[model samples]
Target: MYSAFKIGKKFLHYYFTAANGKGHGVHSPFVFDLITKVLNDTTNHPAYTEVEEQRRLLLQNETVLTVEDFGAGSTKGLTKQRVVKQIAATSLKPKKYAQLLFRLVNYFQPKQILELGTSLGITTAYLAKANTNAVVTTMEGSAAIAAVAQEQFDALQLKNVNADTGNFDETLPELISKPESAFDFVFIDGNHRKEPTLRYFEQLLAKAINDTVFVFDDIHWSAEMEEAWEELKQHPQVTLTIDLFFIGLVFLRKEQKEREHFVIRF
Candidate 1:
């Protein structure tokens, strides 16, 4: 993960170099539509309020649980026990990015969605709520954290979600091997290291279609993660990629005439 100073510097560079957020000069019709429609959508859907309300509750909870680190450990030194409120504050995705994800899912309406991390299930709730008909399968490494996420899902009555608790290496393969596990939308957030992130992408490729969309969180978290993002952009199967500083979105659309990459301000 990047230090505060490094992250600030990168964000400033990204803000200046990235394309306009209003789709002003974008040439690709698909990307233009995304910027104009999905990325910029400001509709205050009821689901947003409901999920945020849950987040408010989580912020107040002070229960502590033993967290198992499977990916790049937090910049804050590793500790066995962490408070629920702290996890909700430090781990959960911010409202802006989480809402952007909701807009993407709401627009694309992918039938099968897979999420690698389920921290407090706030982001998972946003994804699941975006499309009530889609099947969402989210994996969590910590049993304690998974239990909390499960409670959130149950409280929200998000019936389409399946919170699978276990190591992603063991659980992911089993889920992908199933005959009905072809995912059209995937969010990789659990692992932050380069090798594991790349490995997960490779494994998930087998289940992806031409229209499949994959979103990677914390793309610029570290030098290795940036390297992983770059390598993924150059992949033969990836037709397009969009860098939004915090997250990177990959598309495998066969209709693209040429592979392209875009850095768009968000």
Candidate 2:
């Protein structure tokens, strides 16, 4: 409890400082261009409209469904009374994140994409649209939510998306054991708990390609999450890590010699 408070305070301080253009002051050329082109570049695109439309659809669904939460539930939403609208609103992947995911996926054009959480398929939709040739496998814990997401995917004609509904503890292991399991992009948005996050990272590390990019959401969510992100950044395989307050991105590039970690404003 106390640690969460401290993290929240520090996050607020960072937020104010970042907004003033004081952050990312003459960082790596690569990261500087990324910040200017991706983060600071607030140019709205047609895809953003698509994400907003999906958000509207999700928000309009007043239907309530039981949520099978595998991770810590931060909301007052009990496992019983989980409204679709509430979940849409309370979820971590806000509009900004959806936009970022869309832009990143489009830019990276990763052949294989893996998403840890498939909440209403908002992020999944963005990824699917970004790379039509890419095969997207999204895992969702709640059967009801997963069903709804699958329906949304079909309705949108997003043929690349495959929604898997099950307890990730078993599903992830089985997927990792598969013979052809190489992922160029991985989004770690599920199971926000510290130990589980680290465990998942270690387990999936084998599947990453040389140019793999991993994005972990809510690094400043709590002290434990921050610690987990920091430890992940220090991993031998991780050559670069970018801390954008809301998300921490990891890049495993063999060409980069020195380990680099940057905290840039987005």
Candidate 3:
């Protein structure tokens, strides 16, 4: 009962804290345009429908599994013993976030992509569909979820996506240390703690291209996450950031001298 109450409180806090329309009086032309286009995109695409169908299917399967959490679990009292269907139903990607990622992957056509979390691989599939030639490396801390996602990838024939199951903190360092370590697009959705998020941000900065795009999930999930978002936005290399409450999009465009930030309502 206390866990339920805490979740309710967190939801209310987030709902009330979010800035309404006009994105807190944002002034950047590019950000404003991005807000109007990506965040506020109302039309449903075919890809979104496919993803939604898959999500529904995952939710219907009442299979139970033991989950290995590499980061802090958002839910209270969550243990290794949990229902697979429950996780799929309660922890899949939001529609707004899915659309945002779809648009980003479609627009940028990034040759290489790195995703921190592959919870069921819904977001990974969405990103892979955008550019077939794009190599998408999605890391999952749980072998159980990774197994399910790998099956999904096989059924979808998404050959470009590589769903690797392991401890991200340990694997990321080894991967980044390699000579060919560079990613055009990155999504950070693993660790929700401020320190780990900041550490990952700093470590990934070394592999960033001048025009790399980094997307962080659950930026407003907690005060610490929000603080991490703020710190990341203020980084010297970051020139643009778009806050959609749930996700924070970062851009490192060297061509732009001034930094721009926007809060768009979806």
Per-prediction TM-score to the true structure, in the order listed: 0.97, 0.90, 0.87
Global CA lDDT of candidate 3, please? Answer: 0.80
User: Regarding TM-score, does 1 or 2 come out ahead?
Assistant: 1
* Candidate 1, residue 175: lDDT: 93
Ranking by TM-score: 1, 2, 3
**Candidate 2 local lDDT, 91-172, one digit each (tens):** 8388887788887887789999999989888889888988889999999887888987887787677989877877788899
User: Which 10 successive residues of model 2 have the least lDDT summed?
Assistant: 18-27
Score each candidate by Cα lDDT. Answer: 0.93, 0.81, 0.80
Per-residue alpha-carbon lDDT of candidate 3 for residues 1-266, written as tens digits (9 for 90 to 100): 12557656755665676555554465666666666665666767777777777787888877888887777654432447768688887777876677679888887789989999898888998999878899999998888888888877886778899777788778889888988879999999888888889898899999999878999988877778878889999999899887766788899998877887756555
Model 3 quality (TM-score): 0.87
Q: lDDT: which is higher, 1 or 3? A: 1
Model 2 gets an lDDT of 0.81
Best by TM-score: 1
Error of 1 at 147 (Å): 0.6
CA lDDT, candidate 1, residue 220: 97
Give me the displacement of residue 161 in model 3, in angstroms: 0.3
Quote the lDDT for 263 in model 3.
Answer: 61
